[model samples]
Target: MSERSERIIKHSNTFLLPDLGEGLTEAEIVRWLVKVGDVVAVDTPIAEVETAKSIVELPSPYAGVIEELHGEPGTTVPVGSPLLTVADPAGAAYRAEERAGSGNVLVGYGTVESTGSGRRRKPRVSGVSGVSENVSVARVPLVISPLVRRLARDGGVDLHELTGSGPDGLIVRRDVEHAIAFRAQPASEVRPSEVRPSAIQPSAVPATAGQPAVAGVEARTGLHELRRTPMSGFRKAVVATLTRSRAEIPEATTWVDVDATALVELRASLRTATDPGPGLLALMARFVVAGLLKYPELNGYVDTGREELVQYDGVNLGLAAQTGRGLVAPAIGNAHTLTTRGLDAEIRRLTASARDGRLTQQELTFGTFTLNNYGSFGVDGSAAIINHPQVAILGVGRIIDRPWVVDGEIAVRKLTQLSLVFDHRVCDGGTAAAFLRFVADAFENPATAFADL
Candidate 1:
C-alpha cells in the first residue's frame, strides 16, 4: 500500500477526482461500473478511466448507495472535481454540522458534510441517470463552492433562478458561465434563465454559437481540409518529451552487425519443456551489463546545472516498452547485480505493467542506460532518441539469415544489427564504438560472454 492509503481510508460525501500521475490534470471516463442508486462498498472500483499516463480504476470512498455519477463515459473530467456522490449515513452524520474542508488542498480523503441532517436521499429517477424526476422545477439547486457563488453574484446571475446540471444538483462554475452566456445572447430564444422543463445541457456550446462548427473536417475558403483532433494524453506527452530530447542533448549514433547464431543456439539449448528459461533479449541484456561495466563512461548522466558529465556507480537498465497506449520506459534498478534469469523476469514484469497501463511513477523513472529492442517490430535498425538524463540508448534489430564470411568461407548466418545513440557531451565516438563492439562480440561468442558468470 502507498503511504497516502492511511489518510485516504476515510469516507467522504463526494469522491474528489485524483491527479492520476505526474501532475495529470484530467482523464477521460472509459467506463462506469455503477450507476445512481447502486450500493457500493468502500474502495470498490466504480469506474475505469484513461489518464495521460495510464488507465486506472477509480475506487469509491464511501460505503453506501451512489447518489450521483459526476460525468458520463467519454467525458473528460478534471482533477479535484467531484467524481461521484455517496449517501454515507454514519460518515455524513459525523460531519453534518462541520462544513470545513480538509486542509489538503490538492488532494484529500476526508468526509464531507451534506446539507441538512444525515438523511438518505431517494434514488434518482431511473433512465435519467443522476436526475431526480420529483425534484422541484422551480427550486434552486444547492450552491456549494464559494468560487461558484461569487462568480454568479458578480455576473448578476441569480442562483435561485437556475437549476444545476452537476452531480446531485450541485452548482458549478461552468453552470454560472452558461447562465451568463444565455443572458448575454439576444433574448429572442426563451431566456435560458431557468431549467425550461427541458433536459439540461452540459457545457457543450453549439459550434455555431461560440466557435465555428468543424465536424472532424474544417471549413476553409479555398482548399480541402482533413480531420483535426486536439492532441491530448499519451501522444501529447510523447511529443513533448521527444521535442525536449532533440533540443537539449547533443547526440550521436553508431551501428555494427553481429552473427547471433551462437547466441540463439545457446538459448535454445538452455530451454526445456518445464522451463523455457531466459530469452535472447535477456541474454543481450546480460551482455549490455557486462559492456557497461567495462565502459563505465556510457553509464552516466549529464548534469547541465553543474555543467558536469557524471558517471553512475551502478547501472539501472531501462527497457523501452511499446504498448498500444504509448511507449513507456520502465527501469530495472541495479540491473548489473541480477543474473540472466532475474533480468528476464524483471523485463517481463515491467513489460506487462507497461502494456496494462499499471506502471507506477517509480517504475517509469531513474535509469542510467536504456535497451530498446526494436527487433520486435521486425525492423532492421533505428537510431533511437536517448531517454533524457540518461546518456545512452542501445537498439537491437531483427536477426535474419544473411550471407557472412565464416573462417574465410562464405556461409548463411543469423545476422542482427546493434545500434547505439549516445550523448556527445558525455563521451566521444571511440567510447560508443567500443561499447557497441563489446555487445556484438558477446553475441558472436555467447559461451565466452557467460564463461566467468
Candidate 2:
C-alpha cells in the first residue's frame, strides 16, 4: 500500500501468544477467531486458547489488519511463540499517535512521550559493564526461601529487615511472617485522647544478649535457580486475566447461607431416574440457567469502559472443570434452548473435552454466566469473583446429610451450600440475593425449570 519502493508496503510484526495463568508454560490453539486480512482492535479476541485452567480468548495487543496466520488450529505453542503478524504499519503508527497522551503504550510499556514518532526498540544490555554495574553492586541481598522470595518479590515486601531462622540463621518463612507482622503494626498506639506508642516501640526488636552467633554469613538465593521451567500459554493468560480482573474491576462480594436440602433431594431423584439419569451438577446447571431466565437482570454484562450494562438475549452457561493443569471453564452455548437432557449431554461432552484438552476457542470464551462447583473439592461455600464482563458466578458446595426443621419438626435431610458472587456495580445485593433464591427454588422444584419444554 506504500508508494516508496525502499519502504516495503508490508511491515511484518510477530504476535507472540502470552501465558494466561500462573506457571502455565504452553497452550493449545483451539481455534482462531480472526483470519488473515481481517482488521482487529486492541483487546479484541483473536483466538480461543486452552490453558491448564480454562479456555480463554486471547485478545490482540495491537490494533492492525491481520497479514498472516502462522499456526493451524489444535497446534500447541509455548508462551511467547509468534502466532500471527499485521500488515499495516501506518495504521499501527496512527493508532499509536492517537493514544500518545494515554497512559498505555503499544505493547506492555507505559505511555510514550509526544517527541517520539516512530517505533523505538528497547535498550539492550551489554554485559553489565556500564553504569549498571555500579547500581548492581549497590543492591543489597535479602534472605528468604525460594517460595518466600518469589512471594516477597511479587508482594513488594522488602526482605532486608527480615531476620533468618533457618540453618545458619537463614531467613525462613517465619522470618518473613515476622517482617509482615511488624510492618502491619501501627507506628503508635492510640489512647482516649492522644496517640502514643505503648511501652515498646512499634518497630522494636527482641534483645539478642543471650543468643549465640552462627558460623557463616547468610547469602540470598534466587528462586529461578532453584527450579527452571517454561511458562504455559494458558497459565500466562490466567496470570494476566486474574491480575487485570483484580486490578481493574471494583469487586465487592457478600455471602448468604442457602438451605440446599431441597436441591440435594431434587438432584438425587434425577440421578435415580430409570431413564438416562442426569448428574447432580447437570441438574444444578439447569436450575442456574432457569434462574437466569427468570431474573433476566442477572443475565447481563457490565461494560465498565462505556459505563453501561449489556443484557444478552441468550444464555451461555460456563461450567468450571478442574483439569490436571488447572481450572478450565468450557461454556454450554444457547443454554436456555437446551432441554435438561440436552444440557446434561452438552455438559458431559464439554467436560470431557476440557479434561482431554480438545475444546475449541468458541467453547471457552463468550460466557454469559458461570458455575463453580467447589462441592467437588469438599468446600462448604466460597465467595468467588464474577468472571469479568459477566455479572455473576455461582459457587456450589458439597452435599451432605444435615438436620433441618421441616414443618416445625427437626429431621435429617440432604443439604448443600450455595454462594453467589455478583458485581455490585452492575447489580445490587438485593438483586443478587433474589437471583440465588430463585435458583434455589428452581432446584427444589426442577419442573419449574422445564415448564416451557
Off by over 4 Å in 1: 1-12, 19-23, 90-232
RMSD score of candidate 1 (Å): 10.2
lDDT (Cα, tens digit) per residue for candidate 1, span 1-453: 333222233443788888776778888877789866567888899998877666788898778766566765656788999888886755444443333442211111123323356542332222222334554423434654455656776777766566667556656666776777566544354554564423333233234434554332233432223323455466676787788889998999999989999999999998999999998889999999999999999999888888887888888999988897778888899999999999999999988888878877677777789999999999999989988878889999999999999999999999999999999998889989988998999999999979965
User: What does the lDDT come to for candidate 2?
Assistant: 0.64
Candidate 2: tens digits of C-alpha lDDT, residues 1-453: 123322323454678988564566777877789865468888888998766556677888877777555565656778888887775667556545645545323221122333246553332212211213222211323232244555455544554444444444444454554444444545544321121122212322222444422212112321112222455656666676667667766666655555566665666676644675777778788878878887777778777778888888989999988886566678899998887788899998998887877776678776888999988988788867666667778988887777878899998876777788776777777887888887776665566655743
Once fitted onto the true fold, the runs of candidate 2 whose alpha carbons sit more than 4 angstroms away are: 1-229, 271-274, 447-453
Q: Give lDDT per model, in order.
A: 0.74, 0.64
Candidate 2 weakest lDDT stretch, 10 residues: 215-224
TM-scores of the models, in the order given: 0.69, 0.53
Pairs clashing within candidate 1? none
Residue 445: error of model 2 in Å?
3.6
